[model samples]
Target: MHKKDNNIDIANDRNENIPTERISTMFSFGMGDFIYEVFNGIFGAFFFLYWETEVKLDIWIVTLAYVIFAIWNSANDPLIGYLTDRPNRFWKKYGKRFPMVMIGTVPAILTLAAIFSPPFLDPVQGAWIYFAWILITTCSYELFFTLSSLNHYALYPEKFKTDRQRRRAGGIRMALALVGTAIGFIVPPLLIEYENRASYTNMVWIFVIFNLIFFLSLIPGHRESNYLKKRYMKEKEEQKEQISFWDSIRIVLRHKNFLVVILIFFLDSIIGVSLTASVQYVAKYVLEAEAETSIYILAGFILGALISLGPWLFFSEKINDNRRMLIIGVFLNTIFLLPFMFANDLFWLVIAAVLLGIGGGALRIGRNPVMADAIDEATLNSKRHLEGAFMGVYTFFNRFALIAQGIIFAVVHELTGFNANLPNQTELAKFGIRLHTALIPMILTLIGLIIFFRVYDLFPEKTAKIKQKLKELKL
Candidate 1:
């Protein structure tokens, strides 16, 4: 059964059941977030360079490890989403999400560190170390990331059962998160002086400390569940069956829009590569600013945070009606990105960064809440709570983009023979440095816009009507 989509007349909805204090939890996540994403950028963008230059890992091994992680991350993303969403037995003694959240942090931090490391001491020794960390860290990352977020976000209904209220809450939280990223993106530029990349331990420790704050601060107001126990007790009297894994997939596939949404997410992520990877690329080639990329990247996130913190509170988002917001946002962002190729001045770069920030802001503010509304639409009609399954499907779709970026980046570097530390390389290697940051990401974003417009409904009016009807059905 879908449960209640609009519990308006029930006198007490899930949102009302949530304790008033949970609202404060949102602020905790923002304090140092951009740092982790920035860290990821450094790790992802420069791990190859780091390995190539500092630790001197084999390119073949590095490339292979990238492939392994790409494939692994894709498969694991939704698998865990599915597991976490389902009513589970693990939540019993484990105290719902707390145990999962607790277990995940250990590996997440460790794996994050490992992702940048050499495999072992010698070529073979380094390879072994790298591979070991990769596998352990990957699992830890997925488990904790999914566990913590799923538990945290699952509170949306509990926080505000009304559609409009949910959107508002989501918007506020997301805005804070972006701002946190902004803070995260802004400060690190000063800490990291990449000419001394070999001795960036100070910068690394700084990030680790902030991330620890993010990790530890989460404990305060997060809600718990005897949810597993509740599920078991309820299911015994209700369906008396666990959803088969195959049944779960079948249910998601049956929802046409749900499947389409997954495609949209995958497409978004792919095109997103251009946007996400651009900071590092632009800094190197255009600004000749290496680690200082964090400054500009934070600038974009801050811009996005300010602009995006708007629209999430309404039951219906207007973007679907005109979609000028997304289309124009992305178009301007792309046009601005192209300028890096021709513009010689820093002013143009700043302007372009701001433009990309606008589009990026729209994306941040709009994407997830819309997905939630769409899933609600599906549930009210299909009469099944399909959130877990849809997330699973979407995670599966995202892997391709991840793999494509890795391969493309590797090829580009190999071809350019991009010197990580060019003491006195010619102007061409300098160009190679620039290409590392932007060339591919720009192309990816353009294609992403085309894909998003082609397949997605900007705002389905049906989303509103379904919630309305569910109010009548008490579902």
Candidate 2:
């Protein structure tokens, strides 16, 4: 029988005896971000561009695919969280999250490959074929993505066990994710020609190989310990009654703090996906640059982010306030993104990208700690461990970013008379791309930040109480 030790002071405890080991563990854990961001960077940055431009799929068909895909994508998060959040035979041996993470990862990568490898077909006559391919492959990717990534996210608050550790882990994670995202943006332009389907397929295969290598590396970080297994088993026994999935979701939804966090998460998701997806258009239509020139522009953005991270991490540690750090990041990102609309040359464009990255970096560094804090509060209120459930709902809202992006593009493109068939866009269409690239995302991010600032009340003092209570409950 596993006994819950109420006296374990996880909040203050530190592994001072083996500092090297602790750093290694945190680095390994952060490596998972590298894997996640590579796929996200590649997929988000190029998926729409590939289908609409390269595959010559109609913009309406693309948007329709996104809508249908979002339905399945959003639907699975809570279900996967609910189903996998229970104790099973694997709990004692393999640990709960590790197995789910493992199960979801490889298949997701394979499906991502499938998404880029649609059969050669005419865009006009074979529209449905492309639509079916996008729907099936993207939905399949989302299912595995939610399974692996949600559990991985749930693992954070569980494994880190304290605010200081979470902040440290978050900085490292964001740093690696930035590197992966840079590769996603930079590599494609270097390898892909706008007209070559084979180049896109080859790029994805390279990503597949890169993803698998990093996948193997992340296994060490995700390995569960005997202590974690025992603690999970004890928590399971204390659960007493398992609520229905809908009820569980309602409980999480009713938590005001968690809801606010997810709303902000939803908006940020929109900003991230839209900005990445619009990069190629901005480079080609707006800047009139070659395919490879996009790499230099992306390099500026990524470089700014990577360089600014250390300062942001230091500031986060100094303030010890995730909420404030996040707010500042949002404000800066919003302000900086406005320049994208006015930047005419490649130099000015790269400068805007850099400024955008500087602010965005802080937001990236601060979000996980803030989210973990919210989850801590929710768990204390619910009196059960449901990180998986919370992440499920959180991710569900996040997937709506795709839908939002799709709609924004569909409406804007149709109204502006943007033509995928044409080599050069009209001035109105160029303006539309700029709106999708910067203006819309900037407005959405600002709105989210305002709402988050006004409604969210989880300050340091309140979070300290939540952490103390969670520790007292041995959760």
Candidate 3:
């Protein structure tokens, strides 16, 4: 899978325009995102049980309630993407992302507080409260999430001028993001053990407290990119002023290459969402590893985060190629998954986790830069202001992947009767959980290649043309 050269060298000869310090600060956005993911992913995994199992709502009501909250969250993703990019949006203004992010925090926290605050009534009354709180949190969370994420990603082109720079920056961001994600996933299960050995409310508080703290870090350090910098100047009178909002969006949707990214990324994301949602089930059932599985994922996340640094330091510096490296990583992920299908013991499962770590590490480092390269390529063709629209569309495509994943989970949960608080499920139910976790993710990794192969040679020269024009416009 590893090759000597990539399909494109979008910045092979460009001087390193992004300093290490700026990259470090720029990557701080990951800290915010990582916090969000940890809370969002973990809460999604366990909150239903917090309602039906611990809070003890009726199964029929809780099931439908969870579905209602889920659809509410999923439906808002595209809108979040679309609106976060609106240049004229003027409520609270640091820039496009920060305003949306700032505004979103209040609703998100309120919703979360409502979620954890137990309502006192019979099942019917409780269901309505649950629906209202969860749905609101879901909506606010989606807004907070997409806005922060799009703003974070938008910083890339503004701060970094070359492909290598983008990759290295991405590596740092993922490494930190993984650290936050690992802490989010690993700590709660181990640290917040129940006094009664079953009470989950304590754990929910633990999750919520950290989530709040995660956002606080951003308040002090989070600054928006300057849209009117000399470094960011545009040469063409048409390109100098940001393209009109509608025009900007039209450019993104019209690009065919961008479409391929959307297709493959969504497929890959469906697998991601399914595996993440099923992590608890797989750990408890298929691997039969219990708490060890969470530990296993944490270990994998840490290793993956660390491993990403090596490529930025070594291969990204030495080789002008990433396509082959990405392919190598994808297959590494594929190979790692193979072990899970055959793994009969925890020892072998650990090995599979490590391999996944390595594979995921490489993918994390390069993934965003590839998109950035694609965006650069699309801009050359469209010649309109497109970063926001691209970010918006990218958000839409990825969130839909999460939505697809939720569907997978819903189907698999029903299929397997994944009884959240039930003492034990049937052997057949456990097998279905295994299939959800293993086979589906493996399939998606293989399918990712199809989208990648369609890359139509986005070399550095192409980006240089855009950069040169941007420079001339500035002068």
Candidate 4:
């Protein structure tokens, strides 16, 4: 039997005619990308570099800190997800997700600055202090970021009800995200000279302010529609079984499509961290370029991503299959990245960056829509509104990328005998940098592609059924 309430004919009540104003307002939410990507870019690209090189901490110490941070992230993200997914009395007044977003903004800003500004101490004392600080600051940052970001992510499937709408909004969102990523990559190195702590701290201040401004800009766009709220409340009233937190995790893990998506995300996270973390090293060590020269290489990649978004969107639509498009994108990205393993000249590296960016665009554009499809499918099967929970788990596993990154850095540095204090690295160190930049990521991408082909089954027909079920449920 269909769960029905009040004979309100909720399907008829839906605002099918999404207003132009609403679309514009909703799309403006992409501004949140500035906050998301800037922090992500800074952390991924420079955090290790700053700590190990500038602060003069042992690389192994830095690696251990991140491992602990990853554990904290894994624990907190799902807890936050579970908490947010539950029906809240207070959320009724302000909206479920917005309050979390609001509460998190200030703390996020403060912690971001704190991560960059460690107090003065001797290297041994500072290492311990930095370890403690990293743990505290990272947990604080992830808590707020997960609260805000998971909600922001949940809003996508709710707001953009149709695939077409998702595609359009997602394109704009990815474009803005890449732009922020570009700025995050290109601007930081320009700010921090080699071993210059003061300049690095100054860059942190600048980024913190930028994060505050962009995060606040999301306030207006976070308003939940009355229709969605009423629907959720009615569903809550009609819910028969209340699943426990562990059950939710179990269910998410058992979800075949979600597993596929998570694995893809997991692998992609490695690729992302590898590139962001290694680009500066590649420029400085392998190419023997100036510190600021990495900016151009990163810019080439991001600019290519920005330029290629539209075409990727067009091609995905033309192909009418996101999964296929994603496979092609990943394959091509790997292909393009292969050249980077050997490219020592600035010109060739820039060329490879552009091609990789084009492939990156394809990968970026398809991820959200595909994930939304998975969430929709899971919701239909489970009869639960678990976007928060799902995204939480999604992010939880995604944090493994950082752990993997730490391991990569520790192992590669140890193997290659990379010493930050050295005036010049050995050829082995350069080779390790190249491996992180290209070879490892390419290998991971291939593994991801193999898994994707073997497991991911969210083709057009499956998505159509999911959408049809949602329609019947008046969701």
Ranking by TM-score: 2, 4, 3, 1
Candidate 2 at 51: error in angstroms?
A: 0.7
Runs in model 4 with CA error above 4 Å?
1-21
Clashing residue pairs in all predictions, respectively, total 16, 0, 5, 0
- If scored against the real structure, what TM-score would every candidate get? 0.78, 0.95, 0.80, 0.94
Best candidate, TM-score: 2
* True-vs-predicted CA distance for residue 419, candidate 3, Å: 4.0
Candidate 2 differs from the real structure by a C-alpha RMSD in angstroms, to one decimal, of 3.4
Worst 10 residues of 2 by lDDT: 12-21
Per-residue lDDT over 366-403 for candidate 3, one digit per residue giving the tens place of the 0 to 100 score: 56766776776676666544565677777665666555
Give a tens-digit lDDT track for model 1, residues 1-475: 1222222222334442322223454454332233345444445444554555555556556667767766776676567666765665554555444555555554565556545443336645557676566556554555555544544544444334454555455565656566555544566556656555534445555666666666776554343434334543454345456677777777667765556556555655654553455455446544666566547554754674476446322312554432334455455555555555554555666666666566556655555555666567666766655455566566667666767766766676677665554534455655654454455556666676677677656354766677667656544
The per-model lDDT (C-alpha) reads 0.54, 0.85, 0.58, 0.80
For model 3, which pairs clash?
Answer: 9-460, 10-459, 10-460, 234-473, 235-473
Give the Cα error of residue 321 in candidate 1, in Å: 5.3
For candidate 4, write residues 73-153 as lDDT tens digits: 888888888888777656555667767777876687778777888887787866788788878887788787777787888
Candidate number with greatest lDDT:
2
